[model samples]
Target: MIVRVIESDNELQQAFNVRMEVFVLEQKVSEDIEIDELEEEATHFIGYEDMTPIAASRLRFVEEYGKLERICILKDYRGKSHGKELIEAMEATISAKGYKKAKLNAQTHAEGFYQKLGYTTVSGEFLDAGIPHVTMIKEL
Candidate 1:
């Protein structure tokens, strides 16, 4: 899979489109809420398999933390660890920006996946976009 970080509006559009397919279409998240204003200010990553985009994420510095948002992998690609690769890509991008830590709001079911990637649960479970979620963090 080709894991590419967004460097232009075209790349950012690809990343956002993948997120929409996985998060808005598949998961039923409101399309209106899927695209946040932060997209213009954050660093984004796009993961592609054989030149086809499948996973994507975004990173933004928030105070002392790097916030990871819009992380998602296409259903057919879920077990292949593309999601992990995407997160690792985001980590590299954020660390290159001099961030010390990374944070994400993960669906509760995905907490274990993030945990395996060295993220620790930092916030109690809660609802986000109608799905149970929890805040997780990892020190870079």
Candidate 2:
């Protein structure tokens, strides 16, 4: 398994494909909302398994910290810890930039998963793109 920042258009497209399958198709999130204005400014990462892209995530430097967003693993790759790998790669990029913390709005159902990865809830449940989520943060 290999996870790294996207360095080419092909790699970026692979990340989009995974996100599209997980967020747009499976979760019913509108394409307009899932693909947002942040793409050009955010740092993107893609996870590969034996040369196949299986997961992706994005990190954006927001104000004082790094924001983790658009993290998803293809349905066929679920339960394999690829999501964890994806997030770690993003956080590594954040830490390399000298950020002291990282944050993300995690879907409620996956809060515990983020918790296990050292994130603590900072905001009560809220709606984003019609999904129940909570802000979580971790010291980098």
Candidate 3:
């Protein structure tokens, strides 16, 4: 997988397409919530296998952390380490931007995955977009 920071409208759209498939369609997250106002302020990332978009995520500077959001992998591409690659790319970008830490509200089911990537749970479980999540953070 090749992960790239989205730099064009077309690339951003491709990232959105992957998010729509994994979040809105598969996870039943509302379209209104999946695509939100913070989009314009976030730096987006998209991963491709050859020319096919496989994963996507976004980062926003929030307080003292780089907030990771909208992370997803296409159904057909999950469990192949593409998700890890996408995250590492985002973390690299965050560090490059001078952030000392990274944060995310990870879906409960994916908490272990984030843990393996060096994130530690920072808050009790809470509901977001109708799904259970916990705030996690990692020092960059």
Query: Candidate 1 on 1-140: residue-level lDDT in tens?
Result: 78887777888788888898999999999999999787788878888888888888888889889899888888898899788888888888888989989999999999999999999999998999999999999999
Which tens-of-lDDT digit does each residue in 67-96 have in candidate 2?
999988888888988888888888888888
Error of 1 at 130 (Å): 1.0
Sorted on lDDT, best first, the list reads: 3, 2, 1
Please report, as a residue range, the 10-residue window in candidate 3 with the lowest summed lDDT.
75-84
Prediction 1 TM-score vs. true: 0.95
Q: Write the per-residue lDDT of candidate 3 for residues 27-53, one digit (tens) a residue.
A: 999999899999999999999998999
Please list all clashing residue pairs in model 2, or write none if there are none. Answer: none
Misplaced by over 4 Å in model 1 are: none
Q: Is candidate 1 or candidate 3 better by TM-score?
A: 3
Question: Which residues of candidate 2, in runs, are more than 4 Å off?
Answer: none
- Give the Å shift of residue 113 in candidate 3: 0.4
